[model samples]
Target: MPTTEPGRRRRPRASTVIVGALLTVGALVTAFPFLWMLFASVKPRGESVAYPPHLIPSEPTFEFFAQLFNELDFGRYLVNTLAIVAICMLGLLLMAAAGYGFAKFTFPGRDALFFLVLATMMIPGQVTMIPSFLIINGLNLTNTLIGISLPMLVSGFAVFLFRQFMATIPTEVLEAARMDGAGEWRIFFSIVLPMSGPILAVQVVLTFIAGWNSFLWPLIIANDQKLYTLSVGVSLLNQQIATNPSLQMAASTLMVVPILIVFVVFQRYVVQGFTLSGLK
Candidate 1:
């Protein structure tokens, strides 16, 4: 047994202290932009671009947000964003099921199929945009929220991510469940899914962030102002209110804050998923 002597103080190594200080500085630097966005969002129009920029606002108000939601019809765009995000989440369920099959089932050409999927990830999305648009336009889905979400329904990365995480599960446990007469669906839903909380949370947060931050595809698919997502709308600030840094900060804040909250809620599970999945 290791025992500390009475009245002895154990100090951290100098290297440990130095590393901690460096990491703290790095984190502060990384967070500075977000902090500035939050502070600037609440500041009056004049303070947003004030010289010798103030870290804290002198007079904080919610007028920018009010203008955004009330005068500018930002709420419609926010609703569109939520709708698109929800549709994307529904698609994630299907992708996760595909991942489960890829990870667990042994079928002819399975490896080849998965390899093809992974290879697709390397291809630039720009190459496929025109073809995808033609297909969607052929289906008469242009200028609709569903059109915006249609292309995002399939993601090779999502399949790969969930496959890796699910592969870490013990095969023996699944076999035992089968011996007890559980069907494939039963085992997947009742056993596999319950134990896959960490990975599922990870995927959910990833999908939310990707779907929320997505700009180009949504812009290409939907032309109606009512169907424009927050990301798509925020990007048009150059043409609408290009000079107002305050409104820009306010819009950016709305876009980023939800993602931060989602990440915070799932942070523990996300870390756990990565740590455990790597062990396999």
Candidate 2:
């Protein structure tokens, strides 16, 4: 048995050092574009495309942001985007309920039904896009925000996530609630939903990001400028300001900030949900 001297630290293995070095390099490489975007957003339009491509802006200005707000209907787009997100979140609750039913209840053909839902995930979105559009059109919902949000309300992935997470919940707990004279709705709303915080957070973050970044469907469904989401509106902005890199970067920054804030706020729950999901 070898004994280390008091106060002497063992040297780290060469493999550990190499791995640490690689991770540091990888982190820097991943962060470089975002850092460049941040710096570029503050730079003057001409300097943004300078030959040297300075990392730090020589002259920082908020003119690009001001121009973005003043020259565009960004406020209306933001509101539209928020409304879509809210509607999609409501749809997620329905998915959660469906998942809970699949997880907790015994019914004939339940497994077959769930299999069908999972199978939908394998089909390409493009395959159904035309059919979905025609249905929305038939309902006279085209050019409306509700039409844009219609398809996003229930996602197969979200239902699967909820089912996987809810399956881990002990049946005994639900039985106890039933023995206490609690109704199924009462137990689900008061007990199961409250206990589903981590998974719910995961769904919220995923749904919000998906709704926020959705472009193709929104573009197809909404020809009205007032119903345009940030994603579609930003693309229009990009085409108009193609020559002004600073303005483009500013718009990009605005688009990214909300996602960053949402992730930061709920990141802990995401990790916890991922861990729990792996167990089930």
TM-scores of the candidates are 0.92, 0.93
Q: Where does model 1 exceed 4 Å of error?
A: 1-8
Candidate 1 lands at a TM-score of: 0.92
Per-model lDDT: 0.88, 0.90
Which stretches in model 2 have alpha-carbon errors above 4 Å?
1-11
TM-score, predicted candidate 2 vs. hidden true structure: 0.93
Task: Put down candidate 1 lDDT per residue, 1-280, tens digits, no spaces.
Answer: 9888999988899999999999999999999999999999999988888898898999999898998898777899998889888998998778878889999999999999999989989989989999999999999999988888888887898788779888988999999999999999999889888888887888889889878988898878877777788987787776876578888899999999999999999999999987866645
**Clashes found in each candidate (C-alpha, N, C closer than 3 A):** 0, 0
lDDT, model 2, position 112: 99
Q: Residue 111 of candidate 1: its Cα lDDT?
A: 96
lDDT of 1: 0.88
The candidate 1 region of ten consecutive residues with least summed lDDT is 271-280
Best by TM-score: 2
